[model samples]
Target: MSLDPAAVRAAFAAAVNMDAAELEEWLETPESLSVGQKKDGALESVGHAAGRRLVTLLRSDPGALDEDAYRLMRKAVGFIRRHRAQEPANMVTSRWRYALMNWGHDPLK
Candidate 1:
């Protein structure tokens, strides 16, 4: 139920197709991503991979996890910015488009 940094890091590395060491170097400051920190291109890649991992965890069966911890996990996942309004619509993948479209729908609806 707790956020396993090691498992998350491993999943991120595989999801992003980056070397674990390389990602470690890049994420060295995740706990302190400064206001002036600018990754330009690389951060986007990492964020997307991390976001996917987070989504997987968020979508997992609720009863299988600690509700309080899951709530915090969802909050943390919400912080990732994989989509930007300024991006052209065509720039988004069809999969992302579908996911984004469904994202706004109420699951209970």
Candidate 2:
């Protein structure tokens, strides 16, 4: 089962600070492409895929979001929250920063 939608919404609001256009542009960058685990030699990492979903989620109406969308949101929220605590000394160009950005969060913001 997915997380509580209300809790997900609250955590999501706090975690996902980037807009759709901004996230879309970020996902196109080499930095965005460079980090995260890519299973079975797949081109895109899980975080990259989640960022794409966040972009879509940002654009979608809150009332119409499906459970799967909520699940994705919950996952992104958890990932963002956990990784945010592991911030590197070099926030600007660190792989940690890149990984978080891939999940639609710019800690620098």
Candidate 3:
């Protein structure tokens, strides 16, 4: 199945408790991110990190993402986990993971 940017954004916003408008402003399309971009410091925001991950995921084949894409996805999962941990009562984690799985990515990995 094809990746849906709206769905990805919605899932990310839910997972991070970020405003969808804020996420839209922070999210850059996959084509805009340079290959040389560095991931050094803590991510700017969960929304930004999740948006980056979604871009990477969209660019790759879900069944076999390249190493860099996989790494990005893993980082996204980490960011999601960190945010989710802050709100133990929130049920968005499972829904977010389910969304990812539907896009052919098993974030559990």
Model 1, 1-109: lDDT tens digits are: 4566445444432333323343344334442132122266454343334434444544555455554434434433343224323334563433333232222211112
TM-score of 1: 0.26
Per-prediction TM-score to the true structure, in the order listed: 0.26, 0.94, 0.35
> How do the residues 1-109 of candidate 3 rate in per-residue lDDT, one tens digit apiece?
2444445444543444323343343344332232122355543433445564554455545556555554444555555655445443443454444333322233345
The candidate scoring highest on lDDT is: 2
Instruction: List the candidate numbers ranked by TM-score, top first.
Output: 2, 3, 1
In candidate 3, how many Å is residue 40 off?
A: 9.9
Model 2 lDDT-worst window of ten: 1-10
The 10 consecutive residues of candidate 1 with the worst lDDT sum are: 100-109
Q: What's the C-alpha lDDT at position 77 in model 1?
A: 32
TM-score-best of 1 and 2? 2
lDDT of 2 by residue, 11-85 (tens): 888888999999999999998999999999899998998888888989999988889988888889889889988
- The true-versus-predicted C-alpha distance at residue 71 of model 1, in Å, is 5.9
Off by over 4 Å in 1: 1-45, 55-59, 67-84, 92-109
Lowest lDDT sum, 10 consecutive residues, model 3, at: 29-38
In model 2, the number of clashes is 0
Error of 1 at 77 (Å): 6.1
Best by TM-score: 2
